[model samples]
Target chain A: MPEPERDILGGYAGDLLSWVMGRASSGDVWVTIMSNLNIVAVASLADPACILLAEGVELDDGVRERAEVQGVNVLRSGKNVFRLCAEIASLI
Target chain B: MADSVNFHFDIDGDNFTSAGEASVMIKKLLRQMEFSPDVIRRVSVAMYEGEINMVIHANGGTADVNVFCDRIEIVLKDNGPGIADVRLAMQEGYSTAPDNIRSLGFGAGMGLPNMKRYTDDMRIESEVGRGTTIYMTVNV
Candidate 1:
């Protein structure tokens, strides 16, 4: 499935979805190790450019399908959380 | 829209995986109804927080959304351990959610505050052992 291309504005790192929803600006590339389906909801609500899953975290069960159906861009990183954040910062 | 449209959903609180289904459905509905992006985003985000709250605190609940010409009204009701202090719960950075919930990426205590920020009107009615009903409205 294809999602609308989003421009990367910046990056936000947080494990708490509610906090990220409150503070992360629209188009920010959200970075987190949390891999729950609820992340799709927060990303949809916040309108982030995409979600970066660090520390080799991957969602389970039907989550990937939900993310695709909801059209939330999710990128996974094999690197640890700190390294992923650093890489995202360099890009932004 | 001339006549009001009502959308009701049963939020499943037994599992964390399906928490935001109601909000997602509403977002699609509002979009198909040709609501502006701003209105749709505000309504959905506020209700999304309320939905998540229902699952986290109430174990399960019902969400009723009324879409009228002038505003969108969301009534979130849950039968669970009711809020002890509405004021304290409304405060930013104050939370009663256990550490386990926090590890799941919610329970940051910004739920109600964020809901209030996005909607034009909000009211909360909760009883200690009975239930909680929250009404939120965003003007079109």
Candidate 2:
């Protein structure tokens, strides 16, 4: 059996919205610096496979709660948004 | 075209984070109703853009979605300070949204153009001080 293709990468909240809506397939991971509940809204809109908060950013409690409810996998990274995006892109 | 359903939602302008809720629900409903992916995507994107606009500009509004066999119609009405220049507002990359909104990752001025791009048809009715109403349609 063949393994599924991976398209892991980091993105800016603004730039990622449209790409996620039109191009990002399900199961793709998204990294961003945004920390508001609107991040969750965009995530739900994009339906990304998972989300990673980079640049040492912290999400509000409300955002975490909602993401949990929606069954979206959330992660935090010590790296900056750009670094994380680069690392993920290398892996992919 | 014979069978049709209507869905209505009150967009809460107070909470920018909750702006796209209606679009999400509509997307799910369309999926359950077995709409084609293209149709679902187009409708959802267009409605989401409109919802965001309502929150960003209107302080909130009402959304009415009429789903028909052949097409889906979405009407977004808001009672906020209306657009002073429809032509300028329609121009891509032109935005009057405050700087704070752009910081939150929206107000790129792409909302209306993207809405128009995804939908089959669109119309805007507005009075500068009164409010604005937008109608969009997607073929199913």
Candidate 3:
């Protein structure tokens, strides 16, 4: 759980991976409960600074592997997506 | 690079979740080839949108990317239902996608326009009930 070295400027919240893919911006933190391989892909394609997995959802090995290989930073939270997003916004 | 390198991918239309795989792969290859971040992002977004379109409209398709020193070329071909009105289809907000597609955050009708916006050159050929082929190039 290394803190993301890349600085995040803002955040986006969505569960549908494609929706996140089309709108997430570079250097933005992505807020989602999606912990799938495509989430990793979408994060990579969107060039987001990091992906915050809300609600403490667990990522299976496949998704973990993809995130590691793709260099997508995944952070976890016990809070809901809305508050998590707001906190991320304050951090940047 | 001394010679052109080509990357080919099979876009599985049945799997909406896997649509961006090819674009992600190409992004890696482009980065390895030392393309700038801006060019890579443009090509990746344009190609991702095209790949998603293939899966959404066609059953599946083929994406071929050729990388050269000065530019990258992408050609996508599918045997799915051809667009009835290419002009209308290319409009930024006109989408023929069903309601289900919108729930997935796609079928926004921005695919073709986004493709054109990112690429330096674009040509689309289609025949009703036949198929469609899109050719696009991004300069380095």
Each model's Cα RMSD: 2.1, 3.9, 3.1
For candidate 1, the per-residue lDDT at A52 reads 85
lDDT (tens digit, per residue) of candidate 3 on A48-82: 88888899888888777778887888888889898
Per-model tally of clashing residue pairs: 0, 0, 0
Put down candidate 1 lDDT per residue, B92-118, tens digits, no spaces.
988888887888878889999999999
Best by lDDT: 1
**Quality of candidate 1's docking, in CAPRI categories?**
medium
**Candidate 2 segments whose C-alpha is farther than 4 A from its true place:** A1-27
Q: State the lDDT at A64 in candidate 1.
A: 83
Tens digits of per-residue lDDT for model 2, A1-92: 01124344434332435434544544667777767776666666666667778877787778888877655667888897678777777876
Using lDDT as the measure, name the better of candidate 1 and candidate 2. 1
In candidate 1, position B67 carries an lDDT of 97
lDDT of each: 0.87, 0.78, 0.84
Determine which window of 10 residues in candidate 2 chain B has minimal summed lDDT.
Answer: B102-111
The fraction of reference A/B contacts recovered in model 1 reads: 0.73
Using all chains and alpha carbons, the TM-scores for the candidates as numbered come to 0.90, 0.85, 0.82
Which wins on TM-score, candidate 1 or candidate 3?
1
Between prediction 1 and prediction 3, the one with superior lDDT is 1
Ranked candidates (DockQ, high to low):
1, 2, 3
